[model samples]
Target: MEKLLQGLIQFKETDFQEHRQLFEELGNSQSPHTLFIGCSDSRLVPNLITGTLPGELFVIRNIANIVPPYRNIEEYLATTSAIEYAVNILGIQHIVVCGHSNCGGCKSLYASEKEMQSIPHTRKWLELAGNVKEKITAMNIPESEMAKREWMTEQINIVEQLKHLLSYPFIKERVLNQTLTIEGWYYIIETGEVFRYNRHNSEFELVN
Candidate 1:
């Protein structure tokens, strides 16, 4: 807490002042080009990873970086509203759903109900990745290789959420008209490397 406070002070005294003009310009309004949906992992800082400046990317973070299938406004209001506003109001051209290696949320999918009883909301939220679990489980990977399975599931979750994003009618329309593009990203926390899904190759390739 103290560190964060000191960082805030430093930002105010140094970084903020260094970019005073840019901050002033962004004070009134922001026109970001992309909407980044990433996991709520401390190591996977979207701005730091993408090297984006303030107001460059509108970000939304959630457990496992899941994007639920579109529902009525009253449902999942926080995430849904951010999506609506980013695409419709902000006119964001690109949407990126980024998943990281060894994500606890994705790993928790394999946890028994007894282990998750303390986190009811989390257990419920993880239900959004049910499809990923089903698809992975069908592969019949051995329990001995749980580590490999976990990593695969993390990447698969990114693709799954990308599909969920299309469930939004507005998002679908924009995509069909080439007005908006959606991409899946995988980040390796250990190596600080990023990979992007290549639909053409049906595999994730290192992002240069």
Candidate 2:
């Protein structure tokens, strides 16, 4: 927490002063071109990863970066609400769903229910991995290679969320009208190689 405070001070003294006009314009209103949805993992900094300055990308971070399907409910979810505002209100042109390698939450997908009992909320959140589970289970793969399998499933999970994103009426309409484009990405933190899923090729290819 002290480190965060120090960083805040540094931002005020250096980064903020250097970008005063940018912050001033942002203070009035924002017109970000992309909505980047990512995980709460400390290593995953969307701005640094994309080399995007403030006001360029509106970001939503959640545990495991899960995107629950559009649903009618009384309560609100930050991830869904962010998507609504980005797609419906902000009119952002691009939405990127990015999952990363070696995610603890993704690893938990292989745990038994009893093993996951302690982290009930986490287990609940990761239930979205059911789609990934179904895919992984049917593969004639070895347990020794489960982690590698999960990495592939992590990308599959991103596609699952993309399908969920399209379930929203407004998003579907906008997407059909070519007003928006959805991209799935996987960032290998260890290698610093970002892979963008090519829908046409149905494979993740090097981003650059």
Candidate 3:
């Protein structure tokens, strides 16, 4: 609590003053160009990773960075609603689904029922990417190869969420007309390297 308070004071005295003009301009309205869907992990700072300013990225963050397939149900729908507002209302051009290495949510997909019982809501939310585990299983990666399994799971989850984004009619139409583009990114927290998914190659190539 004390650390956060001091950080807030520093932000007000230094960072806020430095970006005062930009903040004033964004005070009335914001026109971000990209919708960044990323994990809620503390290590994964969207702005820090992308080197984007405050108004450049409209971010939607959640456990595992899951994007639920578009549904017409009447409910709160936090993630779905945010995606709709960014694309339909805000008219954002690009959507980036970023998943990072050593993702706890990705690992939770493999957690036993007993282990996940405490986080029932999280367990349910992760069902959106439930098939991720199935894909890993079919890959036949040995349990001994923990690192490879983790890498595959994280990257594959990013692709799966990108697919879920296409399930939205508005997003799909814009994509078809070349008005919008969606990409998957895998971030290595320790290395500070990001790998962008290449659909043609069906692999994640280092972003140089």
Candidate 4:
């Protein structure tokens, strides 16, 4: 708490002052160009990774960076509502779904019922990525090779969420018309490296 308080003071004194003009301009309204869907993990800072300014990326962070298939229902719908605003209202041109290495939410996909009992809501939320586990399991990756399993799970989850995004009619129409672009990213936390998914190759290539 003390450290966070000191960091807040430091930010206000240094970073905020440096970007005061930009902040003032953004005070009234924001027109971000990209919608960045990323993991809620504290280690994955979207701005830091993308080198984007405050108003460049409108972000949505959640467990595993899951994008539920669009549904027409009158409910809270936090993630769905945010996506709608960013695309339909804010007119974002690009959408990036980023998943990171050693994702706890991805790991939870393989958690036993006993282990998941404590986090009932999280377990339910993760059902969106349930098929990711099935895909990994079908690959026959040995249990001893947990690292390989984790890597595959994380990357595959990103691809799955990208598919979910297209399930929205507005998003699909824009994407088909070439008005909007969507990319999947795999971020390596320890190495500070990001890999962008190439739809042509259907693989994640290092973003050089």
Candidate 5:
């Protein structure tokens, strides 16, 4: 907490001052180009990695960077509501669902039931990855080091969640009309490299 406050003080002294006009403009409203849905992993800092300024990206971070298909129910759902606002209200042009390497949430997939007993909510949340395990199983990825499996699962999971985003009527319709673009991205935390899944190649390729 102290470190964060110190960082804020530094920002106020430097970045905040240098970008005063930008901050002033941001105060009125935000007109970001993309909605960045990424993992809540501390290592995967979207703005820092993308080099985007404050108002350039609207962000929603969650465990495993999950993008559950939009739904309407009696209860209030934060993630779904955020999507509704970003697409319907804010009218963002793009949505990027990002996952990162060595994610603890993804790693939890391999945990024994007993190991996960305490995190019932998290286990339920990761039920979102139900199909991902099947995909890996059908492909017969050899049981190997935890790190390798987690990395592959993390990347593949991003693709799956991107599909989840399209489940929303608005996102699907706008995408069909060519007005909105949805992307699946993987950020390798250790390497500081980002890869975008290329639909044509069906593979993740280096960005630029």
Candidate 6:
């Protein structure tokens, strides 16, 4: 907590002063171009990874970076509200769902219900990733290769979230009209490599 306070002071003294104009413009209104949906992993800093400034990307972070399929948002509004605002109000042109290499949420997909009993809310939230497990299981991957299974789950989860995003009527309409674009991104936290899903090839390729 003290470290965070010190960082805040440093930002006010150095970084904030250096970018005073940028902050001033942002103070009035923000017009970010991309909506970045990524894991709430401390290691995955979207701005640093994308080389973006404060007003460049509007970001939403969640426990596995899961995008629950569009539904009537009466109860769960955390991620959904952000998505709606980023699209409807902010007019973001690109939506990128990024999943990382070693994610605790993705790791929990393999945990038994009893094992996840303690973290009920987390378990419930991760239920949105059920299809990721189902699809990977259908692939019949070797049971001995646990690491490979986890990696595959992480990548498949990104694609699954992309499908979820398309389930939104507004998002789909915008995508169809070429007003918005969606991307499934995989980030290697260990190697700092990024891969983006190529719809044409139906595979994730290095993001150059």
Steric clashes per prediction? 0, 0, 0, 0, 0, 0
Off by over 4 Å in 4: none
Q: Write the per-residue lDDT of candidate 6 for residues 102-178, one digit (tens) a residue.
A: 89999998899899989999999998999899998898988798888988999999999999999999999999999
What lDDT does each candidate get?
A: 0.94, 0.87, 0.95, 0.96, 0.89, 0.94
lDDT of 2 by residue, 77-139 (tens): 777888999888888999998889987777788889899999999898898768887887788
**Reference-based TM-score, model 1:** 0.97
Ranked by lDDT, the better of candidates 1 and 4 is: 4
Give the per-residue Cα lDDT of candidate 4 at 173: 100
Quality of model 3 by C-alpha lDDT: 0.95
In order of appearance, the predictions have TM-scores of 0.97, 0.95, 0.98, 0.98, 0.95, 0.97
Ranking 2 against 3 by lDDT, winner:
3
lDDT of 4 by residue, 21-111 (tens): 9999999999999999999999999999889999999999999999999999988999999999999999999999999999999999999
Which pairs clash (backbone N, Cα, C closer than 3 Å) in model 3?
none
How many clashing pairs in candidate 2?
0
Off by over 4 Å in 3: none
Worst 10 residues of 3 by lDDT: 137-146
Q: Largest lDDT belongs to which candidate?
A: 4
Candidate that beats the other on lDDT, 3 or 5, i.e. the better one: 3
- The parts of candidate 5 lying over 4 Å away from their true place are 145-147
lDDT of 5 by residue, 1-208 (tens): 9999999999999999999999999998999889999989899898999999989999999999998877778886888899889999889999999998888998888788999999999999999888887786576666665556677888889989989998999999999999999999998887888999998888999896
lDDT of 1 at 44: 89
